[model samples]
Target chain A: MTADHLRREEWAVTLPSLGWLLALFAAPTLLVFAVSFRPADPYGGIGAGWTLATLREMARTPLGPVIARTVRLSALTTAICLALAIPCGTCLARVAPRRQAVLLLLVVVPFWTSFLIRVFAWRMLLHPEGPLKRVLVTVGLADPHTQLLYSEPAVLLVMVYTFLPFAILPIYAAAEKFDLALLEAARDLGAGPWGAFVKVFLPGIGRGVLTATLMVLIPALGSYVIPDLVGGPGQDMLGNRIAQRAFSDRNLPQASALSAALTLAALAPMALAALVQRRPPALEAAARKEAA
Target chain B: MRRSRWPPVVTAAVLVFLWLPIAVLAANSFNRSRFGSSWEGLSLRWYRALLADADTWRALRNSLVVGVGATLTSLALGTSAAVALHRHRSRLQRLHYALVYSPLVVPDLLMGMSLLVLFVALGADLGLGTVYLAHTTFCVSYVAMVVLARLQDFDPSILEAARDLGAGRWTVVRRVLLPLLAPGLAAAGLLAFTLSIDDFVITFFVAGPGATTLPVRVYSMIKHSRNLPAINALSVLMLAATFTAVRASRRLLQEDRP
Candidate 1:
């Protein structure tokens, strides 16, 4: 068969799914974008008139605090996840290869449980009369009436707990390929431990750290279930507001606007990461030469 | 061997933190107390209640149907997309690969809201069917990624050899590719099914009246009622099911390697 015929045949393979994605996935997002520009009706639907009221109102009051809190919480979650994951990832990489797989699996298996269920488990454990309270009482650390279930700390705790695996897996993947001999060589050549770590260790797992940070940070920003289940009444994240507008208030136009803005904001970090991760031609050529 | 002992200790502590809540959850499922704090004694009262609840069973049934439907459709779409992308090496095709995988990165809330907008615009009633479509949309990206990872190590010479031996496209696909891809497909389908069953945020947005899923049902119950031990029992069972599904998928993916 001719090359043209082969190319056509290959194109045929992608045709079906491409059509499905365009029709279902792309079309819906476009519809949401369209709705965001429309005015809301009292009858729980959008009207034909165009208005920027939703966008304007979003800039005014709750949206600013919501976005600010979301960012603050997400950044903290990412930082804490990275701190915890890096040491654990180092340990994982240092272990025997066979044991490493088992350890990694242990980290991932808990993630397979329902996200809501895990959040609920945290709610119970942090409740006023929960195990944590009892532990604190027994240790004489605090009064018996201390409540952790509905506070900012509770939300942060659950967010970190939930996203910790995402942080660990990527860092572990990066650290697994790390070379300890380089560190030894650096030391042999007269570099201090801190110097060796900064020069040798960080660069080795830099990609993994970036990947882990983005993976955890992006989803953490969009979180709702954690705050809803564990947070106090005033702890509304951007997700909670978006979801409330859509489901509770039935304000489709405003919800669409907020969701559209949130989606755009979420896409920024992913796009930047993708750009940063693109392999350089020099590295590719070096790799090819090494392979040869 | 006088290495620092901090790594192992730190790792152990992290693992404990990871598994403690789950252990507590499972333990509390059998607690006789209404609130799952104090342990009176082991009992099956909550499980008995879980079994007797018609709403729970109905929601479970709804979850299963949605899971199966989403899994099958995702498998077909994902496999085709993976195969095509594997064969093409052009820049546009590389972009296509990125687009196919974009759903994996986009947050679920955005996916749910956008799909809800689309369905409402089309005037389709919100229910299990819409939820099925939404699930399939995201699940396709997941299945495609898994299968594509497997396909990367695949040899293309086999297809050329099959064609050289006078095999038609259909014959080559059925005789060669299908058997080779069996393990990957199984792993992908299992992953897709688990995701569909575990999904809450997406399904909750799309599901209308009389179409409450297991997760949605459980969420509403938790929101409305403060102290229900039955939920703990239900959660424990779901946890067991999730573990089984993940273990099965891991095994299938391992088998795919060879």
Candidate 2:
């Protein structure tokens, strides 16, 4: 083909993605950032004033506490999911290839179901009159629990359950790519199974763990629904507070400011996770081969 | 590898934890008990009641419309965009990638609220149509990212070979590229289906009075009453349908393995 034709074809390949990005994401995000600066009229329309007062109000409200709680809860949830998903992922990696699809589907089954329905189901499972409490009572764990549904544990449970798949996919991708020959060689040199896992396997899957952590942590940090439906009174996350500001209190300024801050707060963990996800090229290619 | 005893045991326990709530809700939907705890005996009374409830049917229909419509739009947009990105090498590809993936990182509630503001300013009317637009906006990226990952698995040499064999671009894409990408597209479409169905926050912001989805309907019902029999029945149906689809996909994925 002619050089000019090839150039035109290349441009044909590039423009649509750039167009979608410009129209859908870049413009929309700019609109949001611009909204943060526009003055909120009392009647819910933008006003002439452009000031930092809305941000100042964010400092005085319950935003600081909400942010702190979100971080603590999300961190705990991520750590727990990691603890559970890693070994499970390792098993999938080490097992027979024939069963991999069924096993992998199991990991993602919860995702296929609605998040709202799953959380709603948890209500039935955790309520005082629910099966969980009945079982606990039958087992003599205590008198049927009264506070399980709205407690911190409920929030934690949903968080972990909802995001655990994120943790598994990455870690499994890495662990499956692990150098079996390396582990075999170590075993030949008298390394025990546990020793091989620690020295050989863990480091191999570290990037996957890091990426999975990112996959879990970012969404968990700014989560809105779980805390609202399952979180106890006075233990609200920043998301609920933002919703309240916009809807109930009609305080759009404070709401926008709170959202902006929450977005800003999530950047650090996300950046750290992204940095960790950028593994050595050899490691990435290994993961891809394993995936194949 | 041999079947170890520990994995099945662990998998069983985890699956039980995962599936029990859904199972309970499904069973209780048939129970005569209003409290949702005891087995007062099986009954289809709740299903009859759900059929007569106009609001419930409306929500169900709305959700179907939204889910199917939204998924189709995303599949089209995302597939095209992923194909374009897959073909060309550009200095800005990573930046473009990071942008598409950004929606995944931000919480849905924030996106919902900011979008409400943006849409209002731009004078886009809010309703079921608006919900469709909102759903497609985020859904495109998700569908794109997954399809892109799948596209990366494909060897570039195959496309080059098709081109070198004197095939035009359209012919190569139609015959060679599209067939190979089928599994990835279907997976992306199914995933988008789940996402559209699960969505509430964005829908809540963008949805108008004429269009309430199933989740919104359930939320509204819970707000007004404690009668969960119907809710449980609906939940059961939803769970079963999604699980069946997922299992079927898994079976196909396994059989399709090269």
DockQ of 2: 0.51
Q: List the residue pairs that clash in candidate 1.
A: none
Two-chain DockQ for model 1: 0.69
What overall lDDT goes with each candidate model?
0.86, 0.77
Off by over 4 Å in 1: A278-292, B1-4, B256-258
- Candidate 2 lDDT over B19-116, as tens digits, reads 77667778888999887788898899888888878888888888889889989988887887787677656666666677777887777877787777
- Give the interface RMSD values of the models in order: 1.5, 2.5
For each model in turn, which proportion of the native inter-chain contacts is also found? 0.65, 0.45
lDDT of 1 by residue, B1-258 (tens): 233577688788889999999899899999888887778999999999899999989999999999999999999999999998888788757766876977877778888888888887778989999999999999998888889888887898998999999999899999999888888899899899989998999998889787889889889887887336788898898888887887888887786464
Q: Number of the top candidate by lDDT?
A: 1
What TM-score quantifies how close candidate 2 is to the native fold?
Answer: 0.89
Residue runs of model 2 more than 4 Å from their true location after superposition: A2-4, A184-195, A277-292, B1-10, B153-166, B251-256
Worst 10 residues of 1 chain B by lDDT: B1-10
- Candidate 2 per-residue C-alpha lDDT over A245-287 given as tens digits, one digit per residue, 9 for 90 to 100: 7777766666667777777777888777656567567776997
Q: Give the TM-score, chain B only, in order for the candidates.
A: 0.94, 0.90
Worst 10 residues of 2 chain A by lDDT: A12-21
